[model samples]
Target: MLAHIGGRGFPPDEAAERAWATALWERTGGRPSGAPVARQIDAIRASGDRTAELRRITAPTLVVHGDRDLLVHPSGGRATAAAIPGARHVEIAGMGHHLAPGVLDRLVDLTTALARTHGARPATTPTPTPAPAPPTEEPA
Candidate 1:
């Protein structure tokens, strides 16, 4: 089912498959469900104009889209990035809805680099621990 939906990036490595399967199972109790057809139709109809909302996002945004994604077309990603102010768009070649095993590190690197470039600082100091409270003296 994942393969049919995800298209080109299906049949991920065994470890990834197991991990994702476990996560999905835990999240949904293995009884996967999607929005109702009516709701989906309504959402599609209402999604026509979101430029104003997109423009209001002030935080640093990274829009990473896979060229081969079948669930959501690549143009949607492009449009999202274009609408958001200063949103960096990255279109990975040959990637689909599901990322290839090798692409994980690249995605992480891209995210880290973007955060660094946008002046987002990583936590340098460890959280200070509080000292233990002194024991109360027992009255005789």
Candidate 2:
């Protein structure tokens, strides 16, 4: 999982990877299981092309992909965006299959922009404010 997340031009973030690993361990009760992952991969492989179906989608679509993604090449994203009529494609730099440190914020911004463009209103619930930055210590 770490290898897949960090490879393909994305530098390894040890802290983030360790946190993710811990989360996964907690979720699965520390059981060594490859069946689920294998099944997902097999299912993806078994699914045939759906270009015609993709083209039939009428809703506004946004395709965001990492240019450096090794799991699925950027060309696949390009092809998907091309198939969907009026689908906007955004290629992010220095990202892989998994979300890196700064990618989440960028994704959120892109999603918000797309939603606003499509006349979607923001949720009524108040958004959480970020914590104040720590004061820098001065050198004596």
Best by TM-score: 2
- Candidate 2 C-alpha lDDT tens digits along 105-136: 88899988989999998679889999999999
lDDT of 1 at 71: 79
Error of 1 at 23 (Å): 6.9
> What does candidate 1's lDDT look like per residue over 1-140, in tens digits?
55654546434676878898799889888786765657988998988889899999999999999887887999989999999999999998767787767678879999999999989898799888999999999999
- lDDT assessment of candidate 2: 0.85
True-structure RMSD, every candidate: 4.7, 14.0
